[model samples]
Target: MTNAHHLQNNKPQDIAINDDWFDVLKISDYLFAISEPRHYEHTVVYLLLGSDRAILIDTGCGIGNLRRVVEQLTSFPITVVNTHTHLDHLGSNHQFSEIMMFDHPRSRDLSSNGASRDLLHWELHREELVIPPWPRDFHIAESALPPFKVSRWLKHDDVLEIADIRFRVLHTPGEAPDHMCLLDQTHRILFSGDILLNGPVWSHLDGGDVGELRDSYERLMRRVNEFDVVMPSHNTPCQNKDLLPLELAASNDVLSGKAQPQVGTDLWGRRYNKYDFGRISILSKYPQ
Candidate 1:
């Protein structure tokens, strides 16, 4: 694993952000997001500078001149990664023939959650749905696009060194069963996918299990000391890595039946509301 010699000794720095047409964050040798504008959509993309080539985390929604935005950055051999199959995480998937995701059985299906389907034609800037139930159709043109190489599926504790940027992958199951977070040990940064957002936690209970989310959070906290900075896919850059513990305290309040479903601003400058359907149901099952 070759580390970029220049990014060393970064003592907890607020990621350099620029709002020049595109929302950006310079995290070490990688870039967090170039901007994706949907409230629930994540605009996180990473420009991993590698020894030989480079890799991008997720393609910004192919819309909004992302093609032009990336070109302004670098022109290395770019490989795209979708934290999962959510439409927001895969807007520009069709743009790249060589993309990858968790090789789970469900990975083959290009469909997404109900909310995502509510965003069909969103990439085309045509989110107008005449019918009340029509908007729940947002997702990729799975059939229209080319086949992807589901060659690599990371497991917990797996380390991926791409674009010369090293990441310790944590298989976080909630939000998306195949979601993974990236960690930069040198700076103790945790590239929390959609798992640790700074806003209201989405209790997407439909197929999501709250118990599992609780477990994942515990696992994440166990390793919180491993990372001092957390770079979430959405919202603002990591301000303090200690937020992990703070979040844990809040979560415990909810888990212990002390708090109600809360809506608040989370990491990444964006505000989020995590009151997904299954939230109440999951919380009800807890011994609280």
Candidate 2:
């Protein structure tokens, strides 16, 4: 569990992005981490190539044309599956025709609901930002996440065999109700969308449930020994597998009232209690 493998705070200074809007990191011959570091979200999408087809774990923020970049890398039939339909995760969903998603009300609602400028005001302000500027033609106010259709409805324990890789879907609902974690049994890698990350784990949204997340983490802890690495959606690309227990502990602390959280507000003006774990943080809305 050394710090050398993970990228902390979305600061990927070592990995060169080749002057593109997205920072591309070749995790392996079959896997790629496409990160949008310029935006405050610091979202990272995984591009996985299998023998028969390719599966994109999540589409980055729709600031740039991600489909074109993905086309440049592989010619395999691409199936875009969302970890969760957050503005940042599925912004570019319209760009692809074939998409797989969880059969949930939120996922269905988000499909037609375009991106909200109100929710994205923090990045739109672009003042005192750490990352670089947006694309030349990019305008935040005018931009909207276009609606797209989901091709397939993914369920828990569904086995997806792409080329040589076999992924088992785990229904993990903490960050979002329909959040999923794809376990690549062949490679021993976990594609954790917003379920896990190196930075603050946001569980303060409308349907974000800390109790549900605590249960999910406990389930994940049971299989922690199976995965070698965790690829989260934001901030970091590769995280040590040992961090799984820490996440479980963080969730437990929140449930048991062991970790005292400080009151804070997120960028979206949502009131929440920020719980700080040693390696990571969790932002959860105080129960009403």
Q: Model 1: per-residue lDDT, tens digit, 1-288?
A: 333233334433334333333555555545444655453354566665556666666665444444555656667666666676555566666566456676565666662322243344443234341112212333334323333455466667877766546667677765667676667664456767666665534445233445566677787887876766666666554545555565555556555656565344433223333333231212222211
Each prediction's RMSD over C-alphas, in Å, is 7.5, 4.3
- Model 2, residue 16: distance off in Å is 6.2
Model 2, span 1-288: residue lDDT tens: 122223222343334443467778877667788888777788899888777788998887778778877887788988988898777888788888889888788888878675566654453334444365667666766766767888888898898876678778889998888898988877778888887788788899888888989888877887886677889999978887766788888888888989899998876668999999866988899653
Model 2 TM-score (2 dp):
0.88
Residue 257 in candidate 2, Cα distance off native in Å: 1.2
- In candidate 2 the C-alpha lDDT for residue 270 amounts to 84
Q: What is the C-alpha lDDT of each candidate?
A: 0.54, 0.79
Q: Model 2, which residues run further than 4 Å from truth?
A: 1-19, 113-132
Q: Which residue runs does candidate 1 get wrong by more than 4 Å?
A: 1-21, 27-32, 37-42, 111-119, 122-147, 262-288
Best by TM-score: 2
Which residue pairs does candidate 2 place in steric collision? 51-163, 52-163
